[model samples]
Target chain A: MRFTSAQRLDDGVLEREFTLGEIPGTLWTPESAAPVPLILMAHNNGLPKADPRLVARARYIAARGYAVATIDAAGCGDRPPSAAAEQARADLRRAMRAGEPLDEIFESLVGPLVEGAVPEWRTTLDALLELPGIGGPVGYSGGWTALGIRLAVVEPRIAAAGFFAGGYVPRAQREEARQVTVPLLFLLQWDDEGNPRQRALDLFDAFGSKEKTLHANLGGHTGTPSFELEDGCRFLDRHLK
Target chain B: MRFTSAQRLDDGVLEREFTLGEIPGTLWTPESAAPVPLILMAHNNGLPKADPRLVARARYIAARGYAVATIDAAGCGDRPPSAAAEQARADLRRAMRAGEPLDEIFESLVGPLVEGAVPEWRTTLDALLELPGIGGPVGYSGGWTALGIRLAVVEPRIAAAGFFAGGYVPRAQREEARQVTVPLLFLLQWDDEGNPRQRALDLFDAFGSKEKTLHANLGGHTGTPSFELEDGCRFLDRHLK
Candidate 1:
């Protein structure tokens, strides 16, 4: 069936606003399926809600019969309250009051603008999980947004996570990788020249989970692999299925 | 000192070649210095000898009081022979017959047109190392080319290595990491979607030297920290000094 942003429950396609508490997101799912696995796809840093990468990924996974929800975290994507320096300062103040570190404060504030439409993302994920056909394992991809989802969602329904050039803040959170009982996959480049390689390794090493797998490619920092989607499919299939 | 092509070395601050053997590269050194430590730098794939990135890097390193050399590998950069399908096919055949990789074969066939440019990167390193007053650790950066240098250089003079998004290739020549006995510092990105995180980890883990360290940053692929050169200089100072 054709994939559109509107909600469609019968042909296994649905798009609607989901609310995680007060957080909102845009959800997409297969209408005809029942209790199928769910995937929480987060956008890359600074990507908009309608980013082609996120949209394409959602469509690809949905065609595979899995429910995919793309969320734009706070201040990101289509969320209102544009990312102005003044707004950022206010968000940072709130995070600081919460005892969160500087990076987390920055992440919570500017993350949305750098990720996607945030309100739609939170609303979408919540709505998708409540659907009859959507349940079971949850996976996350993209970068900063994925890390945000990990913080917001603690449901047992999340069975696995896949990071596509995304990671968590406060360094210590990465140390808690083992706590994420689900399988975790990290994709990176060797000749990136942009991103450092050591931190990714440290995170992998700190991951207490035995299901963690890492794959390296020859591409540079903006290079996408030829089989990234297929690889993601296989990983989700193995864990969520 | 001014940097110039091999043909203009006589008139410039430093004269250099892009590669000494089957590799492609550029060489630069202060015309006033009696002799200096030769620094070998590798470029990322698809980058030519004259790429602005390489030029900037070379110029920066040269200004830092080291003799800098940068090279483009085969199949890319300021050297492309015959750009014709039939000629390219013939060139490949000749290289294979000569027991060389395509890059080496192409370098040999197009030596005259490209001015004896080949993938003799290691040979150049050897020549540089042998130069008077060049005694000390050799430093390298870049992606695949850095790895290539690590594989080919057998000299004991290479006291340290600083890798920037350099580790990506699979283990080909029987435990490549075991050969690296010098201090190594690796810089990586936590959210790199391009390179495989595991391969970088494998390389870090394989480093038998006791002085290996890995550092991670929050940036995505190719994310250079606000002070990358400063950090690199610090790392080099700690080890190469």
Candidate 2:
């Protein structure tokens, strides 16, 4: 994973969009002379690193004094949506939502998606750490996909994570979670239209982190409530600070 | 994993529904004099070990001179559906079907499911091997869940494996597949309603097995065609015989 270029977004923040080979991503770091904590913010499934919500969150987190990075998910962001795959994914998700049984299709879509995303995340983390002042207390925040859950298990650099609603727990990775001791702030939307509530509960139940907390609010899958997001900031603060 | 009880089915197959502690499972073995190969058969999502289709497959495989075992999934069979969790899983799967973007939820579901399952399978395999004539070469057969994909990666005793299409490839588990050199016979239903074709393709692509074969049939997520089943049996015969 190599950084292609870095640009000064403004006086307070530096923004760099890079290609670790084919994978595209954007990194935002506070323009500080001293090293700061880094937050690897992952976009929700289907959303890109440049999505406004992510951009806003990155800015918000960066303003709070941290290096924030968001990468284009597989087939998202600067990358072209995989041909035929994007439509097939949409159709599969639609059928699943229509109360039809599409577990197989869901598995097919999600399994490889996670496989593709996790490696890129690790690579991005490796690259981020190499940059000056982009080190110390690394963390991750993402929605529904809980990609960080796997990261927490595999990436020792991840000291804390904030996982939001929208993802189900895979059976195999459930066991891996048992090895994750990272402090975690898990957010859940009560009426998440994209995920089941129990999956969150199950994942929370499976987490080996003695410091994990579940923050649930009354809403669908969307931008997390401010209070919950604050709770997350505090959680990351406790660990990353 | 412990044996609760053993019953002799009149059909020359000894049926034993045992508990590897809390996990419930049933093991069926041919009432033969010689030690035989064992086939770990898993039901598709939401189906129990006793599901007739699985039973029929188990019986057919047993009649081919092998012992067969099927365990109830986390919420399946005798395990009371995990209390309030089943509905959540249903909704999650629904949202995924609707294409609402629940990759994280899918990961949550599939990760834990595999985490919970891989151990159960290992335990079950251990117990099955303890029984008379249930030793020698071991194999696995299952549907979209493809629970044994991890077993293939982790379990060296697995001489060969037949993974039916419909399950997604977990991101964390993908690298594990590269370690699986087990002779593999991957079965795919051409138009599997539950899984996308690409998922199967990706998994097939990820597998490191030089001796792997893809047996695809044209149909929704239904029964495998006879010819494909026969081809799978032959594949098994080559490894397990």
Candidate 3:
């Protein structure tokens, strides 16, 4: 991994843009002398690493004394788009406009995205932990929650996860959720128009972790309450610190 | 209201046993010069104010600078038993043992209990708020959640509530939940043996509070994680302080 640009925000959080192979990424570190626990923050629903909400959350978490990082997922911003993913997106749009069932459409769109993204994340984790100011026993945050579930199951370095639960989770990932034993803090918008509430509740119930918590608040898809940000940090603090 | 006894605990909390007319009660207050916001802590179901878990929670919240109070429901603790309530309890036990439906039995048992308790609680609040070091804008905590719903609806002094959602809520109370507009922090134990999971989720959905939050953890009825105690204080702290 090579950092291409660096700047310090007003709050003393150091933000740096970087690249690993062809994947673009960003990292935020608190102004601390000692190395801090790393949080691998994936953007919601394959959103870019630079999405405003994701950046805000990254900086907020960094100011709270954790090193946060995010990378552009496969077919996301600043990355070459896949033809098949484009076709799947078009198909999804057509299906929605036609008022068709979404199970297969969602699976096709999200399945490859999760599969492609998890490995890049693991690679980034490998590089981030090797850096001087980033350390072990990481926590995973943000969504696409399918990727979070897969990473939590496969990545032994991730000690806990905080998942945003409004994305379309594939059937395979829902099944994999049963294998994830890491402590989880899952946030769901109670009235998310884009996501069915029962599906989110069922996925939460499927999680195999003995220490999973679901914090559901009243809101639409993008309307998670701000206090949950502090709660997320506290959740990681219990596990990582 | 008449104070029967008072003592200072090891942590500097003042525990006072009191009685209002025929009802027995307890109040815990933090060591502070100024008035603190009150939390009317109802014991789970109709358990007495002196129940061990109730005392522990009351002292914990009191030490955090809130005055917490609880009272015995109509037929609980040291109060005289009502023959009707005893018959309902017997019917409930017989229904559970015989694998029979319990809707009517539960309504008979809890409906009168809630009706009787809510008024007593409101009277206690009236008396407690009149005393020095106990101020207005109260928050309600604990269960016999049916009683909580009724109180949150009828008692305008209540600003927020944290309901422990493991008790058998009467069907009438589930309907009353929609009228409760106070901000709520509802806690559900995911694996609570005695409470149906779907019922708890449905009740949470039915709440009309725009600022409501549901915190579900992996445990049975009495196994809410210790960290939730701190979280509960923070919830009340946000609204009350």
Candidate 4:
């Protein structure tokens, strides 16, 4: 992990960002050495790496002794891609869906853009998981890329998944979601225009395991409140710790 | 306003939607009869009438003894029109921009679609202003319709305006914004694709009056948190009450 910037919150709280893999992210962790669980957060489509809600959530989770990282997916946040590169990335994503090995796909798809930082995520997670008291399970949150990370990487380390406004394309991606054995929690908006309610319901119904659950909130596609984050963390604790 | 559904949050907390004009909207008003300031909220392009943040905001304002209404602008919500009718409405808006009276434009350009319980908003506001204690002050909050409403009406009864994610044609609309003498608040997102930040900044800088203030948040074109609404309510309360 590489340091980007640091700041002290109004109430003497500390916030900082670390560059991990292709994604540069903000990390909020308590000062103590006690190893706590870690959460990797990916923001909604239009939100940036330092979105206030995501920052607040990191702070909240940090206060609870969990390390929280809000990462900007490729082509988002301070690191934006050129127009041609962005189209190429989208095309590469389409190619990967046509059945490519995870490592080869990562190399061909994300490697050129990320370069050296591509392997940093695995190293960082390995280090965190190896910490003395950090025995709790790992979880992922936010939209598309978060789902991509959860589905593509069959990480035995991930104990559960909390999806916020993440939609599975029925004919295309539903089968991938069926393979996830971990307890999956879906957070959806009742009237989200981007991903309609039925899409979420369909995913819930198709989940091969009965361990999955769905919670409907009143916000739109990008409306996940702090309370929901707390609930998600608690759910992760239940399954992983 | 006609009540549609109600959800009671903790004790004395109520969230409900009502059929107002041609749109279904959520109304958050104090339980008591005491007169308070009013805010008419206009949603973003991707949101429905019952977005959770909107409902939360209405409930929050109502809890604070203020009246707030979240309305679905024309051609949205339950009032979605046929393609031809939608084109007619757009033409009517264009005609109104050309200095035509609203009633005449409505008759010639958009009369076919007008029927049933759809209230003419301007007429409704005119009637509302005549009622005792209802003349307090009015304000509009929305993106696409913010400038449209400002341009369509000659002089609204509103004392202030808080626009979120607007400023789409800043150069062309400079003259229209100049006509608004009310203290204006513009909330813009840093990386909004829909409404470019540069355009919003240009529009803010071009405003003729010092009464205008600009706020930047870290969300998409949709919206940020309740700060805009809260500040808007405070602005309206100072002028209206």
Candidate 5:
């Protein structure tokens, strides 16, 4: 791990950019010197780690006294693009334009992305935990929902998870949801234009966790109510802090 | 309207038992001498206003500086029973015992009950608001959910509502849900044994509120997490206070 740059923000949060091997990422920590639990924020597909929404979420949760980190996915942000992923993206666009069924297209696009991103995230998690001022029990939050699900199922360090359910979830991943047992807070936008509502509800049902909660609000893909930020913080506090 | 009994509880909540015409009810108010917003809690079918759960919720919300009130439905609590309602209950039991289709039986049971209860609730609302220390902008919370939908659609005074989606929602009431425009906090027990989870999700979808939220927790009908009480209070405070 190598630190690329660091800046102190007006809100007293320390924002640092780093590179783990080839994976670029950012970390945000509060002013508190005491080690705090960490949150690994997973961005929506195509959203870079530096996207404003992810940055705002990172800052807000860090302000609540937790260290927050997010890393660029396999072919996103400052990283080299994958030829296969670009081909899948073009296929998705063509399928959508032709009003064709998109199950295979989505599977081709998101399946490998998740397959590659999950290990990168776990590896990043490995390095992030080794850093000073960031401590365990970690929480996995936000989209892609599939990544969160995979991590919640396989990552023993993730004590809790909060997922945004507006992203494409591959069919095999939906089946994998039955293996997740950690406490979960799943948020769904009832009117999210880009996501199928039934698929989201079905995924919420498939979670095998004994303490899963789904907070569905009326809104488009980006219209999740702002109050959820604090709510997610409280959930993390209950489980992590 | 007549006050049948009044007692000041140890927690500084003023508990009052009252009757409006043939309807019996209870109200809980904080120690505040000034007026406070009111929450008209609708009890689950057959659970009466004085049910322990209802009392606990009322007192809890009352302590939050809001006056909370609940009243007996047409054939619940100290009120006289209707022979017709008795027949419907018997039919419901027989259908359940035989694994017969229950749509008509549930409709017969809940549809008229809501019809009769909505007007009684409105009349009680009139009398309660007229009383000192109980102010405008009432919130309707809890079940029978059909009654809440009816009251929310027909009563203009209710500013917000929090619904428990464990009760059987008559098909007609599901249709009426689209007309309820107030901000809503809908709670669903994802594994509620007595309630169909898909129906609850569908009803939540049909609600027309521009600002509706569904909070689905993993539990049976009676297992809503305790933090939801405070969550609901904050929701009401957002619109009612």
Candidate 6:
């Protein structure tokens, strides 16, 4: 991992960018040199790693003595979205619009990307945890629900996680959620259009975590209530810090 | 798995259409009272389970004392092609015309379907293998190569397998091919349009099968040479039965 530069963006948030092979990502941490809990953050499909939503969350988390790391998912940020990725998205959208079962489309685009991303996340985690002033348990906080669930499910290194309601969980990967045993906080947007209420609830029900929480709010997918994030942070603080 | 009916289709070839829940599939066995090696077959994108190419292959294999079976890939054949599958095809065609990488589009549609199909294949295999005369050391011979590679990698039950060159292998899933160790025969069309020559050779090189053979012929993806099929049959006869 080669970190290119570090700049204090906010009063307490220090933004640093780095690379691991072709993967480019940014990290935000408190300016202080004290050891702190680390949270890996991700945004929704329409946003980049530095999307305002994730940046705000990273800032909030970092301000309270936590280190947050995020990397652009393949073709998401600072990288040209491959024509292949674009084509996959178009197919997914067309299929969804046509009312066909979107499981195959979702996985076709996601499975390999997830396969590629999982190792990257683990590698990033390994490199970041080695940095000075970062220590102890780690957690994941992200808006793209399945990426968070999928990551948490496959990589047991995460202590606790909070995933905002977004994408669908393909039937093929649904059983993977049962493999997740860490503390989980699911932020469900009751009126999320991209994901149905039942789907979110069903996924939440499938989690193997004995210590899991679902924070349902009236907003749509993009409108995650602030208090819920706080509650999620408190959950992370309890488990990670 | 329930066997609804078995009908003698063409002299030596007997067709049995069965269902497992909503899944529809077919089996072709030689009209005989003896046990034989079985080959589970899958056709490429241009064909269905009963596509002339696959049906012909099944008939030839069955005539040679091999029971061949195939099912509608989820959202294919008897079932309506999901919008996702259709969209993926369209995207692939457009990308091929535009000289863009088709792997993501292929994977986006195929990956999830493959994931869903794997367990179904296992279930179908379990059910078929239990029937009176159809016995052990099952083999998989299929087009749309990744599904076969993915299956052969994960499911050790397959005794010996052959996969026709079809789709591109993503880097993430490429390593999984290294897990395949059964006696393998890859039938390659030298001038395949959907699958380029180098990709086929590369994937063949990645296979962990120490007993693997690559039978290459001069033709496009659509025009498979006849002599190569006979050679492939001999290969299957040597290892499968």
Query: If scored against the real structure, what TM-score would every candidate get?
Result: 0.43, 0.48, 0.97, 0.41, 0.95, 0.49
Q: Of models 3 and 4, which has the larger TM-score?
A: 3
Clashing pairs in 3: none
**What is the total number of backbone clashes in candidate 6?**
3
Tens digit of per-residue lDDT, candidate 2, span B113-155: 7777888888878877887677678898877335777888788
Q: Is candidate 1 or candidate 3 better by DockQ?
A: 3
Which candidate wins on lDDT? 3
Better of 3 and 4 by lDDT: 3
- Candidate 6 per-residue lDDT, tens place, A1-241, comes to 8989989874758888889888898888887766888888877653678787778888888888889998988878887787877788899889978888887888788776666677888888889889898985889888766677778877767888887774486554567888888877677665677787667767776778766655554446677646555656767877886
lDDT of 2 by residue, A1-241 (tens): 5567877665477777778878888888887888999998886667777788778778777867789888887787688888655975887878976877665666666667777788988888887888889767898887634577777778888888887763465555666777878877667765577678667667666677755555544457773555444445666777888
Model 3 error, position A184 (Å): 0.7
Chain B TM-score against the true chain B, each candidate? 0.68, 0.90, 0.96, 0.68, 0.96, 0.93
DockQ, each predicted model: 0.03, 0.01, 0.94, 0.02, 0.92, 0.01
Compared with the true structure, what per-residue lDDT tens digits does model 3 show for residues A127-203?
Answer: 99999988767999986788899999999989999999744689889998999999999999998866789999999
Off by over 4 Å in 4: A8-13, A20-23, A31-33, A85-124, A127-136, A145-153, A168-172, A224-226, B1-241
Q: Model 5: per-residue lDDT, tens digit, A70-125?
A: 99988888798878887888888888788788888898889888888889999989
Best of the candidates, DockQ: 3
Give the CA lDDT, 0 to 100, for residue A103 in model 4: 39
Interface RMSD, all candidates in order, equals 8.6, 21.9, 0.5, 15.6, 0.4, 26.8
lDDT of 1 by residue, B114-202 (tens): 22222355566776666665654677655442343344346565667666663344333225566677766666665565445555566
Rate residue A53 of model 6 by lDDT: 77
Docking class of 4: incorrect
* Per-residue lDDT over A132-156 for candidate 4, one digit per residue giving the tens place of the 0 to 100 score: 5554567665554334343434566
* B78 Cα displacement, candidate 1 (Å): 51
Worst 10 residues of 6 chain A by lDDT: A210-219
lDDT value for candidate 2? 0.73
lDDT (C-alpha, whole model) for all candidates: 0.57, 0.73, 0.89, 0.56, 0.88, 0.76
State in Å the error of residue A196, model 5: 1.1
Off by over 4 Å in 5: none
Error of 1 at B152 (Å): 15
